[model samples]
Every structure is written in structure tokens, then in C-alpha cells.
Target: MSEENNIPSNAPVFQIQRMYLKDLSLEQPNAPQILLEQTQPQVDINLALSAEPVAEGVFEVCVTGTVTTKVGERTLFLIEAKQAGIFEIRNVPQEQVEGILGIVCPQMIYPYLRAIVSDVCTRAGFPPVLLTEVNFQAMFEAQQAQREAAASPTLN
Candidate 1:
């Protein structure tokens, strides 16, 4: 137990650092008539995740999604969230860096994005939307496993 106390105070730290919108897209299938309709709309949401390195020790992860709701094709509401974060990682292994950016940082930054999406949707004349939680850790593991499988050649 005594050996465990020797861990340094400043170890490899994982932090959100900062989050922003790298890009965003919004489309209304029936904008003109939808603007004139009055009804409670049902919504459908889709989420997408992507990560890319900008520079050494710096990376950007984008979590984007679309919300489409229609009052019989009148397009009651539609919005998209393109949330991204710039993470500063140091002292971690190179192989682990992708997981850090793709999984960890995005998990930390998602709530803010969710709130933003909910608020934007509500303020845009639609009901508030609550996005479901994402499992980034599991996603990371899956990604790593896929990469490993791809790298290994099969003897046919």
C-alpha cells in the first residue's frame, strides 16, 4: 500500500480544455409552409461522431446530429448540432491518444452540446429535446478492436 503513495501530483491529465462548433448544418424540408403551420410536432434525431488531429498534441472531435420533425411534411422543426472540442493531452501513449480524443473528451463535452441543442430547439419555436447519453468508453474499445482486426492479415 505504501508504494501507491508515490504517484506524482502532475500525471497525465485528461481534460475537456475547450469546446466549440467546428461546423453546423440545418435544413427545413418545407420551410415556407412550416412557418405558417400551428401544431405539436414529433421529432427524429440522428448523431454522428468524427475525430481528426489538427497538430501535435492537439485534436478536434466533432459530434454532429440532426433533428427533423414534421407536421405532415410541413416541417415543424429541424436543427443540427456540430459540437467540437480541442483537447490538450500530454504524456499519454500514442496509441491511447485516439481514444482520448474520440471517447473521453467528447463524453465530457456532450452535455453542454445537449443543453445547447435543447435550448436552441425550444427557443426556435419547438418543444425542448433531451438527447440521450452516449457511451464513449465502449465506442473507443470497439474502434480499437476494429483497427486491430483490420491490421491483422488472414492466412487464406
Candidate 2:
């Protein structure tokens, strides 16, 4: 008789342990004057993602967003927020780890980061700055391409 278990012991494992707001900062340098401006303030947003191993099979992934609103030469307000998640990943192929970290993990955590940024802006007496949906797969591909280009030697 052949005996085989339903589940494999080394099957790929991926799980989210926790998600939370890692850090947030709001700065209104020219508050009173900038607030009085009749002209619409220009909004600029920057986002960054990072992942690091925290334990044997645990990783911490973080997404940071920075929003800066400007009225002409004056700064209206700036908001920087970092959202992080603790994920457990194991038994996966080494080749797939990079994609899982750069694309999959960020996709799971980005929505919460967006909501937090918008909520903070609204509570701070400013219109909500809704973050647009991101294509992490495309981003990861672009980054990989960039790294490859950088690594390859140019012919003289």
C-alpha cells in the first residue's frame, strides 16, 4: 500500500502576520498665509517601497508616501506616511522571492497606506489627496530592467 499525505511539508507558504502604520508626519510650514491663498495649490506625491528580512521566515515590507502641496513659492503642507506589514514566506523557490517581495507584498499593503494618507489630510483641514492605484508588477519589471542595464558593461 502506498501512503502519501494530502499536504506536502515543504509546500510554499505565504501569510500576513500583521499590518500597521509605521510612521506619519505632517508639516504645515506656511500654514496661515498658504491657507489664505486663492490659487490652487500644486500637489506632488512620491512613493517608495522596501522589504527586509526580520526573522528566519518573516519579512517586513513597507510602503512610504509623501505628499507636498505648494502654493506658488510657498509650501502649504507636506505629509509623509509609512505603512508596513509583517509577512511570513517560506518554502518558496529562491528565484520567486524577489517578485513576491517587490510586487505581491506591496500590492497587499498599498490600499491601507492610501486610506491612511487621505484620512490624515482630511483631518488636518485639507482636502483628501487620494492615491492612485499602482501597478506593482510593471514597477517591478521596470526596476529589474534598470538593474540589468546598470549591471551590463558598455562596449567601448
Candidate 3:
């Protein structure tokens, strides 16, 4: 084995490259009527996670969420959120980048994203929303396996 291999290269190194809002939108369908009617608007929320490679050793992990509300047949509001974090990812093997992005980076970015989503909703005159933790490692591995499976067809 070469010195590089003998030295155990998988050391831990992670950095925050940047953080920004990739997208955001808010809408109130029945602006005047919804504002007047106050009957605890029904709320529904959904969330998703994603990551993209930006540079050789940098990747961005994003969490997006949508909130929908209705007050007795009239749309009260719609709030969408996209919070992203730029991560400086080095020392990890190329084969493991997806794992890092899917699993580790999401873990790091989730809190900030949750806070952003909650804060935004609160500022928009709604209660704060606390999103649940995501299983990025599992999601990453599943995606990797899918890609590998796609690349190499098998005989069933």
C-alpha cells in the first residue's frame, strides 16, 4: 500500500462555506376575506431535502418546505421556504461524497433550516413550525444503490 493508503486518509474535516435562501414565496388567495375571518385557519405542511455539488470540495444541502392554510373554503395563506447551506467538503473519498452530502451535511444544516422556516412563518403572522429530523444517510445510500443498480443491469 502507498503511504497515502497506509496513513488512513478518511479524516474528519467539514466547514461552512455559505448559507442563503435559494427560494421563497408567500401568497394569500383570499386576502381581504381571510384577514377578516379568524377561525384558527387549518394548516398543513410538507418538507423535502436535497443536495447539489457546487465546486470540487464544496456542496450545498437544502431543505424546502411548503405551508398551506385554509379558513372555511377560502385559502388563507401559502408559504414556501428553501433554506440552503454551503459546505466545504474535503478529505472524503469521491465514492463517499453522496453519503456525506446526504447524511452528514443534512444533519448539520437541518437545525438552521428548521429555524429559518419557523422564523419565517412566525414573522408572517403564524405559529412557528418545528420540522422533524431527516434520515439523510439512509436516503443517500438508497440513492447511491439506485444509481449503481441503474448502471449495472442484473439478471433476475
Candidate 4:
């Protein structure tokens, strides 16, 4: 029974310490004139995820989203938002750390990022830009494959 109690201490642990909006920017470079255009503006959205070690057994993961709406050659509005979370991951295997950081951590942080982007857009007097759900596992796998390909020697 005592040995069983000790097992939990050595077991893997993953926890979210806190989540926050790390940065947000809304830019309407060509606001008044562009907003007057009758044609629908084209919307472009880009997202990026990153993770870094904050302390021993603690990591900060972030999801950044940029939404740019354009009316012809002029810009309507641009929203850039970064949402981050601090996670505590302890006793996890080294091999699995990369997957957890690249996939799971981003999965946890992305919804908040989406909300921030949408809210900022609506508050800026533009229609809300809803970010589509992401498949972090697929993204992680593709990144891993890309890294592997880059590391391999090319024979011409």
C-alpha cells in the first residue's frame, strides 16, 4: 500500500497553470474610406503555434492569429492576437514531451485564441472572423516530417 502511494509521485503529470491573452493588436489602416466600399472585403487569416520552457517542468504555449480584411487594394482591418497558457508537465517521458508541447498544448490554447480574434474583430466594428477548428495532431506530424526531411542528406 505504501509503495502504491509512492507510484503516483513518479507518474506523469500535466496541468494548466494559467491562460492569458499575451498580445493583441487591431489595425484599421484604411478604415473610413474602405468601410464605405460596397463590395465585400476579402479576409485572410493566418495562425501560428509556439512553445517555450518557462521554468523547470513548466512551459508557455501560445497560439497567434492574424486576420486581415482587404477591400480591393486597400486594407480594411487587421487583427493580430496571441493567446498563451502556462502548463506544468512533470515526470513525462522525454520522447513524448515534443508531442505534448507541439500538439496537446496548442490544442488547449487555440480555442481561446480564436475567441480573442473574433471578439477583437467584432469590437473593431467589423464582422466577427471565426477561426476554423485546427487539427493540431496533423500539424505536428507534418512539422515532424518536414524536420526529418530537412535533416536527411540529399543525394543529387
* lDDT by candidate, in order shown: 0.76, 0.93, 0.78, 0.90
Instruction: Write one digit per residue (lDDT tens) for candidate 2, span 1-156.
Output: 124856677778899999999999999999787787799999999999999999998999999999999998888999999999999999998779889999999999999999999999999999899999999999999999999999999999
Model 4 residue 11 CA deviation (Å) reads 1.5
Q: Give the better candidate number (2 or 3) by TM-score.
A: 2
3 versus 4: better TM-score goes to: 4
Q: Where does candidate 2 stray beyond 4 Å?
A: 1-6
What is the alpha-carbon lDDT for the whole of candidate 4?
0.90
Between prediction 2 and prediction 3, which has the larger lDDT?
2
**Which model, 1 or 3, shows the larger TM-score?**
1
lDDT per residue, candidate 1, 1-156, as tens digits? 136776565567555667887665556667677777667777788877888777766777888867888787566667888888877776688778877777777787788778888888777766688888889888778878998999999888
Candidate 1 has a TM-score of 0.73
| Candidates arranged by TM-score, highest first | 2, 4, 1, 3
Q: What tens-digit string does per-residue lDDT give for candidate 4 at 49-109? A: 8899999999999999998888887889988899999999999998799999999999999
Ranking by lDDT: 2, 4, 3, 1
Q: Supply the TM-score for candidate 3.
A: 0.72
lDDT by residue for model 3 (14-92), tens: 7887888888888877877678875987888886788888887778888887878888777888888888899988886
Candidate 2: worst-modelled 10 consecutive residues by lDDT = 1-10
The true-versus-predicted C-alpha distance at residue 147 of model 4, in Å, is: 0.3
lDDT of 3 at 16: 89
